[model samples]
Target: MEIKLEEKKIKLVLIILFLGMILPIFLTHQNFKIYDSITKALELWDKEHLLIGMLKLVIMNTLRSIPMYIAIFLLFDSIEIIKNGRKRNFEKVLLILPIIPIAYSLIKIFYDIQLPVGKTSILGVLWFCYYVKFDLKNITYVEKYLVFLSFIVGLQWLDVSRFFNFLGVGEITSDLNKAIIFMEADVIVTLICISFFSFFTLFSILLLHFFKGQEERIARSRSEMENRHLKEVQLLVHDLKTPIFSVGALLETLTLQEEDERKKLYLKKMEDSIEKTNVMISEILSVKSEKPIVIEEMMRFIFSFLSVHKNIEGITYKSYLKKDYKLKGNRILLSRVIINLIVNSWEANSSVVNIMVKDYKKRLIIQIDDCGDGIDIDNINELIKEGVSTKNSSGKGLSFVVKTIKEMEGKIYFVKKIKNGTKIYIILKGDEYGE
Candidate 1:
């Protein structure tokens, strides 16, 4: 969805750019046409000048329309032709579609003209290419340049009548012969106009390339900074984990050796808190790690973790475990995910939480539903984004959960409940029962 939004913005920018490019041409054409009409009022408005003026208008209009033409083509993602429940071949259809009208138009305008109709409308195939996911933007730079060159050539071909006359190849009419003295002057002026416009287009392309280069450099810098920050974070997490491990081991030893009831209870609580911290630290560090874990053992650990939390101890809940399955991922990471979700539910002041685990043919589906004021529909998409949360905490829990699930090639999504709370569904790929 985000990618689609970005693409839409790009299209809008291109539309604005193309409109800007065409606006000047229209203004210039209108200004020149008025000036020329006034100056050449008494002069003979003969066949040659008429042809020249028409051809110039055609070329300018076609040039102005190029961007909009491409934009219109981009509006369709796919084009399918079906007849009698059978899909026809699209390749052949698109190749022939644009040429038919262009051929007719050309022939009607210039009965004696000759040009390759198929080759002239080659750019038209870009429409088909776009629909089939073969956009010009995806091609190599050199190939893109070649395509642009082809487009220029095609535009010239569309004005083949003027092109041939400029080349001194077309049949001469008696009316034009009478005005032959002015023909050389007209041809020279037309050539100059074409040359100027060509240079302008070239300059625009070069300017676009300069912008593209700057954008690429900025993207590269951002990627480098992200990589550096990731490395620093990994190092810091590793350093923190070493002391946490030692403390946890020492706490375990002390709790096992102590015999006094009050001291043992206090020690046990401390040990549980330390163990939870260790699990959270491990979750942060090894969220991407995929190790074999038994689902039943992980669930037992999750229940133990929840029992220690004061908030969740009083909440009514139901659990249905169809079967325990083996998954390949960090056990602590999954535990952290469940803990974050359960905590969120408790914070929402949910009276009841339902947990369901199902083993499928090739995946495991876990659903957690709560009966509190549900998440706002507007905030659903933003829930897993970093720095976004209902609680006033760091808001990294759900984000971390999302990242871990993605690393495991799993999916986590919200299923809106009918009553008041939110329902979160987690699907993880794993071996089917007895498979």
Candidate 2:
């Protein structure tokens, strides 16, 4: 699939080259009448206002260069799309293309003159410079526009009349003497423009390349750091299983020896809690595998886990199970998700935390509500983002929940605008549902 996409992009690049460079040369012919009109316009403007005359010249030249600009922009944009597959704003390209032709037609109708309107290979040198600088470099619209303007302005300073003369398409004017003077002045300006924009293009390319390199380095550093942190966590989880095993063994011994029924029950509950912890730790260390989990059994396990923590002062956990449903997921991981949410509610100073499960239209719904210092409405959205935390801890808990739920093809929503507490809804597909 990737190879096919690359082949398509290569074909597009070839088409753009043919249309932008080769086809233009074959279709366009030198229009001396356009040149005559430009020189006359410049001569008239010079008599009225020299500054405005030069400005008009620059504008006319830029107008003539519009098609080339469009082609260059398209080529640059297409290359970027091919390399990165990220879409860029081509609105400027769209807006400019239609507007230029209409503007040129209006000018021709109003002034009774001809202007260079079609593509030409005359600006081939400038296009080459643009390709060299921008072909592989990612640049902003502002930089593109700036360089485009510079290219237009720089072309005005070139001795184009001399260039035409060299190509055997010399002066159309009857006065050779006037053309000689114009050519001499144009020579000096041409040399200066060439030196200036050449250095400008080179400097811009180098600066952009440097910034791209710095960004890539920063990304690599971040990835390496994350990988190291994950490895450390795996080692810690591996170390934790030994102590948990010892606790489980001790609880088993106590349950076997206890004579009183009440004491035996307490020890049995402890053993069950420790066993769940060991399973959770194992889940963390192993690659994920999903199986059908009966919702009632999962909730019972969660209730047991929460009951063990009920000794904490001023906290109450309530549950409402409307129906039994079967869901497909990692049971230990899913239980941890609920436990994490309940723990968060407790830490929020919540006096009561309610867990409710129901089935709606073949989907399983789990809602958690807490009345402690309910989450601030403003921070609700930020809560699920990795590294953002209201409690200033690692902030991975809710992010983990979100990721796990997504893996199970589930959706989670935080209900803002609630009267006095945080309300969360988790919706997932159910394999089976029963009353």
Candidate 3:
């Protein structure tokens, strides 16, 4: 399946490049008035100042190629959207599109173009080679820019067209002979420049590729290390369950033996707390499959769990649950998610946390509001990313919540609050499961 997806991506990219390459040819097929005006303007500049004429030529060609650049950008961006099923920032395409025309102009400035090979053809070849070798979408922005710069410099300095033209054995016209003679004196200089730039560009690409590989390797190593640590922690938690089970059994024995009413009530509460701890430990150790659960029942368990286990001093909780709904998900995991959010609010020094649930027939809406040092509105999106946290702790709670919600085909949003607090809204597909 993965290989087939990759093949599809490759075919899409090739089609985009083919269209980009052919677009310039189609646009310049006929001699238009604008082309003639630009050519006459460049001629006028050439007669006055040679340097200015060359600069204008570069700029004019770049301007002419803007349509082709826009086409390529749209094609590439459309392909990305189709393949990834997500919208990307248009600014990224805009940022890279101008580089194509500028690079083509630079090549024209540095190399002498011969007949039978139009400037657009050379541009096509350069684009084809660069994109075929490196996928622009997959690389980092810095790497993309550097690799493109190296590609332009390498092709410009190679002057492959001149070398091929010089080696042609076909009958040459007098004009061609004269052009060869004119460039004859600079043969040695051209050869040296080609050799130096080719080697430099090749080395630069290799060095950059090596550094990219090293970075990927380091990232993979860190991931493996984290996985190993997580396994160790899981094992420790499993070991703790044995002692927890023993404590629950002892509490049960004491609760049954107590004769005093008040003391028996206290002992019963301790037993209940110990049993809840055992259930939590079991949840941590066992993976629960998705099942139909009553939303009201789950909320009741969550509220009771938080009130008993996480009743931090000076912190309060308020719930406004209006209707019952049936949701298809792991009940324990969902409970853990709400419990984690409330605990986070408590840790944030919230005086009060409010949880509101509303039923919308075929959907369920849950809103959690907290009166605490509010979350950074600007970094709300970043907060859900793994290893990202506003507080000084290992940032995994919200990440876990996000993953769990996604698994259940639900959406979570952090809405900006006008007052001194944070508002979180969650939407899930469900049905009314009456009282």
Candidate 3 structure quality by residue, lDDT tens digits, 99-218: 454544543454422223333335434453444343344455465445544544454334322443443311222232233244352464356546755775786578567756766777
Winner by lDDT: 2
lDDT of 2: 0.58
Q: Which stretches of candidate 1 lie over 4 Å from their true place?
A: 1-230, 241-259, 279-287, 314-323, 432-434
Cα error of candidate 1 at position 233, Å: 3.7
Clashes of each: 0, 1, 0
Candidate 2: tens digits of C-alpha lDDT, residues 1-435:
011123443456456433433322322223223444445645663322322333344344544554445555544454322113223334323333453345435545655444443322345343444444433344465665565555555554332323343422212221322433543444543454456546655564555566556657777888899778867887999999898999889888887888999999888888887887887777777635677788888877877777757623444444344444577778888888888888988887776777777777777788888876677655554778899887889998998899889878787877643566788889888555343
Q: Which 10-residue window of candidate 3 scores lowest in summed lDDT?
A: 168-177
Worst 10 residues of 1 by lDDT: 169-178
TM-score, cand. 1 vs. native: 0.57
Flag clash pairs in model 2. Answer: 350-372
Q: How many clashing pairs in candidate 2?
A: 1
